[model samples]
Target: MKPQLAHSRDPEMKSSLQELLIYMIFLTDLGILTFGMVSTDMFYLNKVMSSLFLDTSMSETGNTNFKSIESVDDFWKYAEGPFLDGLYWDASDIRSSIAVNGTTRHIYYENLLLGVTQVRQLKVRNNTCSVYPAFRAFMKECYGPYHYLSEDKEHFGLKNGPEWWYFTSQSLSPWHQGLVGLYSSGGFTFTLPKSKNASIDKLTYLKEKGWLTRGTRVVFIDFSMYNANVNLFCVVRLVLEFPATGGVLPSWQIYSVKLLRYTTYYDYFLAFCEVIFCLFIFSYIIQESIKMKILKEEYIKNAWNWLEILLLLLSLLAIVFNIYHTVEVSSLLEYLLSNSFTYPDFYLLALWQTRCNNMISVNFCFTCIKIFKYVRFNKTMTQLSSTLSRCAKDIIGFAVMFIIIFFAYAQLGYVAFGSQTDEFSTFQNSIFTQFRIMLGDFNFASIEQANGILGPIYFITFVFFMFFVFLNMFLAIINDTYSKVKAEFSVMPSREFEISNRIREGYRKALAKRKLKRKSTSQNAILYAVRQDRRDKE
Candidate 1:
């Protein structure tokens, strides 16, 4: 991270102070915004809580308590409400209260979900006491002797306990309910209680806990009405939970986690970019101002090298940010998979949404600076020419391969789809798909629709070309060419000098060949004359 000077006649430290000052002003404004974000975090939490409460029809119970608890102790004290007394058990009490008596009071029916047979309805009551385990023996306590750490809450809460976590969505029809979307180490896998119809001899077994009869229209079952004496209950409880559910469960506090996540990454990325910009400014200033005796070539080369390395790192950081976003998106996909309703293509539409835009901007900045480096250093045209020639050769090779494949696929597509559908029936549709893949605009839905409308012949053909042929070829080319681009500027030279050297070499070779020919002819003539004289004397 050391700042080095530029190599020049005066090497006046590249005075970028003005530029640095402007950046500092901008950063100061940004700092205010960042501070505001932190300060408003509580406000965002309240907003999320309000939204969730509205979604669950809890707003009518009373004015929503969107107050932020500044600490875990505050959360615990609030949880001592009468409503939680019946649901959770402390670890000491868990061993004894293997079974609990609970009457299902009322049930409301919802029909939005697709194939799910049953969904649970959360009951509300002002007088009902909420059950909670004592901290000393709470099975959900993070630091307890027998408690398991809860991913959602840092401290013990009803959500941290197996009883509450499992019941949260157990009876809900997957079709109507939204599965919490939280990114995890891998794709999502959730386990629920074994089916009631499962054989008794099966390892998984449960007893009917209780039933709530709201009317003839709806019946809610409280599965905790009965408890089985088995050592495998904890395993069964663990199975009911989602593997990818790392954030706060979505009941009340999930939005807080989501907002915090977005805020954290967003600020970090912005900060990283700012730091890089600062370093760049500082280096430029030092290069212009410092006048230490250093070899001009060595100094310039080193400074440029440092710039290149930093630019590469910036690109890498942007890539990681994009990847993290992609992971978040994949988690959202898991939620959709768990539910049955078809939502509009929000994720697809938002794919390039801010996340991709930031990455693209970062890449553009890096590339612009890189090109600027060559111009600023006044690299010779001959070097530029050589670089362009190599690039041209590569382009030609790639074009040839692409054209051959395009034609081949287009022809095959015509044969397969021409009679069946208008889309891929002609060579043009095949070419369009190829173009889309190249531009990273390929759409699975459109492709599938084309196949469905046309037939299996085109589907199989296009799939083969898209996956086995195009994907591999494109990736190989890009991966192979990356190093070439990185090394290109180092070996640039003047075109005029190269041509002159070639001409001189040709002239020297021609003159040497002529001299050799003349020597051989004279030697032959001399031998012939000597032979003739000998014959005459004899």
Candidate 2:
């Protein structure tokens, strides 16, 4: 049956209007709820999809095993073919049947294999060897147990030992393997098998002496053998593949690169969103600076806008790159070829592409912006002598303050961290770690691990500096500088104005002097005429 539509012009249409309004409200609420639910589901689905294989070589199979799987056909059959869509991945290598309680349960173990599933205990069994425990041992063997955050001894207790994060690396090529050390800005290191020394450059002589063969199995250890003190973050493994040609040229030999996912994708998604928001902020700043009429210094404003534009453009590029990598699986080859001349494995590329989109790319763009703003733009001060002295004073004042803060934090870190911290115990480390803390990344967990007496004090001091002193000081300096610069520009006349005023004054004075001279000459001529007339009459 068709429902009758009521005309709103009639007074009797009140009932129909109320019903329509109520239906509209209900529909809006339902739409909002549906959208929210769909967004959440899509986010989770993206995470799952991104974790799939994009690395060229997905595992850390030994050279011998990798050699056995040589040839494109065998490679597909043994490794690539197994993980393709619709093929059942045989967990048979890592899976074991264990007796739990009275029955047997299938358990899959997570060893050192890269691009594989994580280990999870589905059920508990009596006298059963769960895969998790063995996986932990295997992890210790493959990737050393180093941690950025140490446990709190007073709270968690010493008997339990230190809580740590494990790091690992997998080889992509049969002979050439790479290691990446993770740090705030830690760089990468490549470890080549003795045979691949011909392909890799800058390898230590000791590595060359080790065994040189195509099939020899070699472990590229990250930590120093002489010292048990392992780096808190060092490249466990990074696999890069290059062309099969021998070339000394720096640009030609480089191939593809990849990094593993130590953290989740949401961490990156949130970061990418942050990059967009940051670019928005830069755009807003540019608009605001343009609106600031009081600032007569056009160069400064232009420089600032240029930086803002550069940052916004870089950020947009990063966003587009991330979106492309996220959506298309084949773009990795293009990215590697353009940037580093290497085509990273699919999984490595996926990890690299995802990580690039998330934090690394954003951070890189941010750092570049900061460098240009502080160092490059500030150098322009040298070109103008009037502002040079003031600029020098400001620079020196900031440098001294920075030095004092750095030393104070270094001392605090040294006293607080003591021997418990590796890669951050020395004076240099104390300074670096202090800088990280100053950036609001102070880890209380690491602070609680120090010697009972000094640990708490150090932790407190560091936290106070980071959260209270540094953060507040940073903002305060900006506020103060803004006030000073605004006051100067607002009160003082511009250089062009002063020059124009002087020129007009000179012209006015010249005209007035000319008029005075003309009047004097005219008066003198009249007196001479009068004197001549008197003489003629006499």
Candidate 3:
């Protein structure tokens, strides 16, 4: 009997080992699949995606002046102070040229289009123009003349053209693009027209004021040059090359590239693993459905089943979109390579990629949530579900009533204090502000400033009804439900465990009955053989 028992236990141990091996293999496969996906994404971002967003050309050039007058106009509209006050230059100077040895004073403007702080060197002829003599003198006094003056013509585009007068300006630090920076080294030349007389009186007036001297010309510099329209175009081009925001929409073109790249090696392996796992899940669901004998509609009525169906549908969509996007990108690349100068329209590609990303993000979230289904078999989870189920209707009713009162308070606050406080400036803001107040972010000073008398009354009443009364009631309902659910769960086994226990008991009984029948049959056979022998003897 001991040997028989040990033999029986050997099969069970083997079965357990087999199950463990399968689990380990599955986990390894899952890890590989995840690693492959993530590695591909990182590679794409580093190698390809990042290039799409960065303006490599601009970076190489160091200073690419904004060409549009609209940008300048926009800059002037928003700029203030004496430095920005008279900073506008005649647009006609763009095409005009400065004389060989002549000096003229003019203002040159540069817009830092990308909102980044830049150090720029402006080169000018030795006798050309002096940039804001008073400002320059102040900078020279503080930081020294060498720090504010550089004679490097080749560095500031002097070699490009003889007519070009270089002007160098250091923009405010990148974090503070709104503020103007102090005067820095370098200068630009502006040529007075041959026919027009030099304004000596104006020069003398400026000279007496120490703005200019016999040799130095004066030029005013400003660096507030962001234009919305120009920026939109830049953003689109940038997003195509890198992973930055293109206006309001997110850029996911690089992510798509990574997904496509990884598919070459891991696609089949991942697919095999996914299919095996999904088949098991599908069969289990089918078995459950058959046992329940429920209609299709009834089967989907379960939240968990609905989630499974949704996950399946989303996965299918993701695969289809991925394949389509890959083909499109490949075709576009081929065409671009052949044409050289031609560019493909990436707007549709970006749009499709955005949609795909949204789908992927939603699928990832649902996958995370689906883990709860397996955990739902646990006793604590079962009790939690029961408590939530029992209290759902009451919670919904309370929420509806609470919302009505909350909205009323929000509207009242908006109407009463909208003019006085920014938080309560509108109906929408008032609602958010009221929520903030509940979270203890309320400012009594702002409320008191709005209306001293009504402010305290509103605060007191809102806190009493919303926080003290309704909030306590809400907590009490949940606590009571939890207590009841816990007591019930302690007394009775979970539904899943109860069903499994019954099945195991029935299987054991069936095995016992079969053994008894087999033993009885053996005894009958022995008796029959003895009877036959006695008959032979007779």
lDDT of 2 by residue, 50-87 (tens): 23222223344423122244332333332222223211
**How does model 3 score by TM-score?**
0.44
Quick one: RMSD of model 3?
20.0
lDDT tens digits, residue span 1-538, model 3: 2666656655554454454455456445444544444434334333432342222122333322122112222222222211122222333555545222222222222211222111122222353334577677554322112213433344232234322445442422121111112223344433212112232332233334432222222122212122221121111221101001111111212223232342344567766765664564466457556745756567767887777677667766766776787797577557745643322343345445656667766766676666555444346667788999999999999999999999999999999999999899878899999999888888878988889999999999999999998899899999999999888767873333322343477689999999999999999999999999999999
lDDT of 1 by residue, 1-538 (tens): 1122223311322223333345456445334333432334434433433443223221334422223322323222222221122122222343342232221110111101111112222212221222355643543322111111222211112233332332332221222122322212211112222221222221122112221111101111111111111100000000011112121122321211121123356566765755654565456456444522344456556655565556445545645655665585556446646752322122221323334444545544554454434333233543454455556666677678767867776776566555654545457776775566555665545544545654455556656775677668766665555546537655643212232343467689999999999999999999999999999999
Please count the clashing residue pairs in each candidate, in the order shown: 32, 17, 14
Best candidate according to TM-score: 3
lDDT per model vs. reference: 0.37, 0.38, 0.49
Candidate 1 residue runs with Cα over 4 Å from true position: 1-385, 389-405, 413-538
Over 4 Å off, model 2: 1-344, 355-396, 411-418, 421-449, 460-538
Higher lDDT: candidate 2 or 3?
Answer: 3
Compared with the true structure, the alpha-carbon lDDT of candidate 3 equals 0.49
- Considering lDDT, which of the candidate structures 1 and 2 is the better prediction for this target? 2
Q: Over all chains combined, what TM-score does candidate 1 have? A: 0.22
The candidate 1 region of ten consecutive residues with least summed lDDT is: 230-239
Q: What is the lDDT of residue 282 in candidate 1?
A: 55
lDDT of predicted model 1: 0.37
